[model samples]
Target: MNDKANNIKRQIAITRRDELGHPPLHLDNNSRLCLNCNRAINDEINIIEADPACLRLNVLTQSASQTCVICNAQEDIGRLTIHCRVNVFIEVNIYIPDNVRSCEHHLDENGMFHNRLLPGLRFINRPYLIKGPQLQLFLQHLRNVSANKVKGIDDKNLTEDEFKCIAPVSKQQFEELFTYCDPVYYNGKLRQIKRKDLLMFLCKMRQGLSDDFLKIIFDYHSRQTVSSVAACVRTSLLERFVPTNIGLQSITRENFIEQHVTEFANELYNPRPAEPKVIAVIDSTYAYVHKSKSFRVLRQSYCFHKNRHLLKPTLIVAPDGFILMICGPYFSDAGNNDANIIREEFERDANTLREWFQNQDIVLVDRGYRDAVPLLQHLGIDHRMPAFLQRGHRQLSTEDGNESRIITKNRWVVEARNGHLKSVFKFLGQTMNLQHAQNLSGFYRIAGAILNRYHPLINMQDVNAEFARQMLQRSTVPNAIQARVEVDNLRLRNGQWRRLYGEDVPDFPLLDLGYLKDLTMGIYQINLAPSYIQDKLIRENDKELQLDEHINEPGFLRIRLFSRFRNVVKHQIFIAYTANEMENIDNNADNNPISGYYCTCQSGARSLGTCAHVASVLWYLGFARHQPNIKYPDTSLLDTTLDAAYRQPADIAQNINVDVIDIN
Candidate 1:
């Protein structure tokens, strides 16, 4: 009877659970649904059972979605929904803990939030997580953006300032050059480097920077890489850029005459009726070099003029400073003098200079090219060089002096142009290293090309041709006063003149600085005259002056001044002055002076204009002397004579023909 009662109790419990519409606690593996709501659970949601027989579903989902079905069912059935087994996964791994006790939360190391919690779930701190593939894609996108911002050589994205730092030419000009040197390849690989970058590298090299320094600045991997790239680019530039920009073929003879030949050059150089068709100024410039290991090379590279090892290159430029051609980085030995190098350029079968040059083409040169004069004459070329000083004469004759000055005035452009090349490209200024010494010709050629393409005209504008013409005409005139004084032996006639010093001549004329500049034709000599005067004053206290009362006309005074080039050497300068008589003369007037002037200095003897020595005397007498207690800025007091003596030990000086004089 008791067993029958227990069986009835178990049956009643089963029947009550069935009447409540509850399903079995365990289901097949294919079933994934909440027991309370009989709804499908999301695969992403987590489900947890409280016990094997009683299912306690913990559905974890995003907060943006509706609450889990189990929670809704529990709420509808009038049970507490707060204890329902469901968790929302909103704001996961979003906020990090603040160890500094600040009011705000901070981002994690990966720039993301940490310690994210769901609405019904417990708060937890964890590492910020991102899918591997998503993170990789995002990083790659950032890399692409950064690369796009960085401009390559060929790109037109660089600013003008940035572009100019690399290349002397403009972007448009570089593009044109790019088309010419476009197909540069190295080691069978198409050059990935941009033309602009290559050009910038070349310019940096020319600027005299070390390969190591360039590598750091340019983001190159190694110094070797920078050197290699620079070499390749330089080779390309020499092959294409130099031929088109620098060579003789670049400009036709007609164009050269019409555009480049200045009117000042024509007037000054072509004064005679038998003038040549073209006037070219020629000179040799030296590049310093290291002492070679080989005895033959060391002997060959020694330059007596520079007192060092050097390479000499002949530069032939137009009178306007346009470089026409460059010939040979000839060895600086005795046999390879400037004259010989120039002769080779003309006579050598390999050279085109002889074929291109026509008869009667005037070439202006300095005294260094005197040996080449006969060769030039043989080729029917008229070469004009400065006259040499006579051995016994204190100064050149007035005619010879005047002729020399004319040649110098026109030939100065070539010297200035050579200076410009050295100034712009510092690589040329410094002694080239052994590695680059082998390719000196190529370097020189490239430098010439760069200057021709980018540098400004050496003579910025044509000089006043009319003024030049008048000067040229006046240079031919003989100084009557100078001739008379010499013929009459006026300097020796001491009784005919009163001796005067700076202190005795208080009536010295007053003149303006502008007047001095006009007299000298340029400020360089005038600016230098004060230093020369200061040097003379500091070194020699008792400067002598003699006034010739016999030759004194109404407004003229003849004075003899003692001048010295060095301590042991003394010379006399004869001055014929016509005092300014106009009471209200403007200070700016060019003729405001002791108007008529001449000196015994080589250049002053020329009727072309006054020399620095003559200008200095005139300035001192007219302006500087009249200023009471005026002070001049002290210049370098380094006595080169003492410096040289100090460099040598005592006994060696006696063996060398060194004549020691007491400077004190």
Candidate 2:
């Protein structure tokens, strides 16, 4: 009986069917194909029933559909499909259905949305279906992306101040520079990265950080990666960016004269020029480098003047502090001095520099370029340099001093521009590595271009036009006070002078900042006023004589300040003023109470301006002492330290014994 029943059941199971003449339980939702695909019902005849063996298993699927959401490509669905991630929707604000398929070409190898194709994402309003594991995976991935974005040197991660502090350019300037960079590819890896590499290059220039440290900050895999990135960025900038911003070829001589030339420069150098001629200041700045193992390179790079191994890059800048061109960063040896480097630059005519500079153009330089003056004259270029001290003269003559002051005032722009360059790109100022020595030219060019494009003009002429006119007017006046001192032989006699205090002189002229600035014609001396006064007040060594203690007579003050370079030498300073002057007067007024000033410094005899020592004395007696609770520079740290060069072993032993360590 059991055998007959089993045979009947097997026959019935083999022939099992529903009302639709299909397999039994064929109407189940799990077997529904028409809902998942928009195919005809008959085409769904090949649908296989899903096994219900593990009802709790939640396996992740590639997508709910075979078509790519990005490009709508249907072929090779299984091989080329990339399931969209949660970050894609969050970043682009285009909803990507969970497990939506995308072609491999549409996404980056990192499985992220392509930057170029992200905007083309099709709109989808369908509800998302995510399994538990998929949701958990997405949450973890999002956490990682967020953390990396914050921790890495990404543009979105840093604030405007942070960008300037790290890189030298503002946030907007940094962003604007991206348009000039070329987009390179790692197509084999299906990844495209940029901008951050440019930023890394800037950071390298601005902070002067080592490759290893840069690698850590930028999340690069190794120091070699950082170096390669820097190299690539530098090349890109040199080719695409630098040519349009810096160098002699970038700007025309006519445009430079019209746009960059300043009134002060014109009046000081050319003096009401009839023809359009270029007036620029030229100078060289040192870029310190590490000592090399090769003796030849060491000999070539060593600078005896600066006492360091370095390179010299000659800068050509307009009087308004606009950089016009940069020349060779030649070796720092004797053969590659400033004059030779500049002479070579002119001789080579690189980038048509010789053509750019025409005849009658004035080149303002310091005394170091004296050898190049003949060459400049040969080329029909007028050159103005500071006057060299004659062999027998301890001081420059009045005419030489006046002419040199005008040249120095115009030449100051180049020095200020050099300092600006170092401040912006610290790599130029700092001691660079030997590995970077070969790329110094490219580095300097890039730095100059960026500085020109982004930074504001330094030492603008409009702010100093009146001041320059005043300097010119003052230069013509004779030093009446100096003549009087010399005629009376006041400097030779000490018996005529009497020791007196500030109260003893009841008629000294009290001055304000503006009057003092007019007397000096610049702020450099005023900036040093507090420090000089502080030096006297501190009295580190009591052997020095005080200026206020030896006033000679009413309406006159005299003092001596030790030479900065030589302590054994002293400079005599004298100031004559109207008695009973208790208030400040207009700096431009003719009836000024302070009649004249004189000093024994090399350039002190010039009536155009007072020497630093004279300015310090006048500033203190007339202005600084009258102010209450003035905060001077702190010198406590310096006072505590001893000079290693002058320190004796016995003195060291005595100090060390008092603070000796007790290891026992």
Per lDDT, the best of the predicted structures is 2
| Model 1: per-residue Cα lDDT over 1-664, one tens digit each | 1245334333433443464456744333443323522222211122212222332222222221222212332122221111111111223422211111111112212122222312333222212233477446545645654565353343366687777666656667777766655434565543433454466565664577787777666656578777767766777777778888776777877677777777777766665533436778899999899988999999999988778999988899987788888888899988998788888887773356775666877899888788888889998888898888899886777788878877877788889878877876777888888788888788888778878887777663325577677767777878776776678776577665655565555545556666665566555566555555654554443343334445354334554333545555434455654455543346555664444556666665766666777776766666665554434443324432356444322232122222222111
User: Per-residue lDDT for 473 in model 2?
Assistant: 79
lDDT per residue for candidate 2 within 102-178, as digits (tens), equals 66665544466667766555432222334588668667867776677655588767898888888978888877787
* Top TM-score hit: 2
Error of 2 at 598 (Å): 1.4
What lDDT does model 1 reach? 0.61
| Residue 473 miss distance in model 2 (angstroms) | 2.9
Clashing pairs in 2: none
Q: For model 1, state the Cα shift of residue 171 in Å.
A: 6.4
Task: Give the alpha-carbon lDDT of every model.
Answer: 0.61, 0.71
State the local distance difference test value for candidate 2: 0.71
